[model samples]
Target: MSKRPYSAANPSPDKTAKATVDAVKDITISEKASDEKKDDESKKDEKKDDKEVSNFVMPNYLDGSFHWSYERLASAALIPLISTQVIYGAHPVLDGVLGLVLPLHLHIGFDSCITDYFPARNYPRANKYMAWGLKATSAAVIWGCFEFNTNDVGITELIQRTLTA
Candidate 1:
């Protein structure tokens, strides 16, 4: 029997091998392009999510505003606090102001610490009531200290005597 000459219809082993390699290279290139497209899409999605998060505002549950301005005022009050403490017994007015303000400052600082650790998001109703109760208690304490300063031997004097003794 005579062997048929290789034609377009019947590729030789060499041609078939080259065709297979070329097909694989094309498939690999296409797959790499698709992967790069997917990566670009994911990066765009991440940027969108980041923008949304930045624009989002946390809902306020409290009745009144705790403005950033108040925080600045609280920070400024620290100067007087340190000055009064150092002087200890400069004047009756300073002692009385210290008596009221010191407790308030302490309460605000403590409440902030508590709020940071035990956020309102965790227990909405409980957190609101807890914060209100803390504020009420702080007010009462401040009032009592102020009264004590007015009625008794000023707060600084009392503390100094106690510390010395």
Candidate 2:
């Protein structure tokens, strides 16, 4: 084996061994410190995540945050609306309300499907186009319902007429 070149800066063998031990001890201490830091950081992250999840603010009714609530309320409203229509027969007010609510309920359901199937992260262009198309279709449908309720026999009458026929 080639001998290492010795210089004034180089320590003697015993001193070199002591120095190596001290370096190892320093490194181990530093590693422990770093590990503690990592644990602290991870704990902080968990706390932040918990805070974010728990601090939900109710947004405006028009916002996506309220979508599930709106959908559920609309669905619940339908049971009473339909029940009243069946028991009391056709009323213009009920027909108009049904026309509005039914189209809106359908729109919400279809919008959810589009959101699930064409998520913006995976299909940005398709998602945008589909969302706009859905908006237009829903608007047209709601408008058609309004027109029919105003100018024709309206929705409940049409349903009754169809069921009887």
Candidate 3:
């Protein structure tokens, strides 16, 4: 065997027989840690599935309207949208992306007040339309604020193609 000097980055120690045992023990610990991480990821996946299911449950509207009123819904969204920028100091672009990508977060808060706010009760229906509208609006609002419609060359080209189409 070729001799290699002790490197701290490696588990092996040099100049002592005990170093071999230490290296073996270190390997076992690392393997155990890796196994634990796999277990954690499996657990996270399970939780994610559960959350997805719960997110789609129909609301308790109970009558001609939803659980909340339009005014109340608007106020609810206003709080978070403002707070995210004013208090939490989220970048406007990042905030807008979040607003588009996960519009449901804001939608849910507002749903407590809006009669029409529902999740995917029927695919490509009311809830789906609302979600899509919110996403589009969020993107437009963010891009407008950032002057992206004027400043972004890529967006301008894409817009030209869309307009031509």
Q: Model 3, clash count?
A: 3
The models' CA-based lDDT, in order, is 0.77, 0.89, 0.57
Looking at model 3, residue 42 earns an lDDT score of 90
Better of 2 and 3 by TM-score: 2
- Ranking of all predicted structures according to TM-score, beginning with the best and ending with the worst: 2, 1, 3
Tell me how far the alpha carbon of residue 6 in candidate 1 is from the true structure, in angstroms, after superposition. Answer: 27
Ranking by lDDT: 2, 1, 3
lDDT of 2 by residue, 1-165 (tens): 977778769767988899899999999999999999999999999999999999967697445768998899889989999999999998889988988888889988998998889888899999899989988998898899889989999888898999999
Tell me the lDDT of model 3 at 49.
88
Tens-place lDDT per residue, model 1, 1-165, is 987799999988889999999999999999999999999999999999999988967646343256344555777876877576667554677777777667767776777766777788897787788888888889898888888878888777777889889
Query: Any runs in candidate 1 off by more than 4 Å, and if so which?
Result: 1-69, 88-90
Residue pairs clashing, model 2? none
For model 1, what is the alpha-carbon lDDT of residue 48? Answer: 94
List candidate 2 segments past 4 Å from native.
1-17, 28-64
In candidate 3, which residue ranges exceed 4 Å CA deviation? Answer: 1-116, 122-124, 148-165
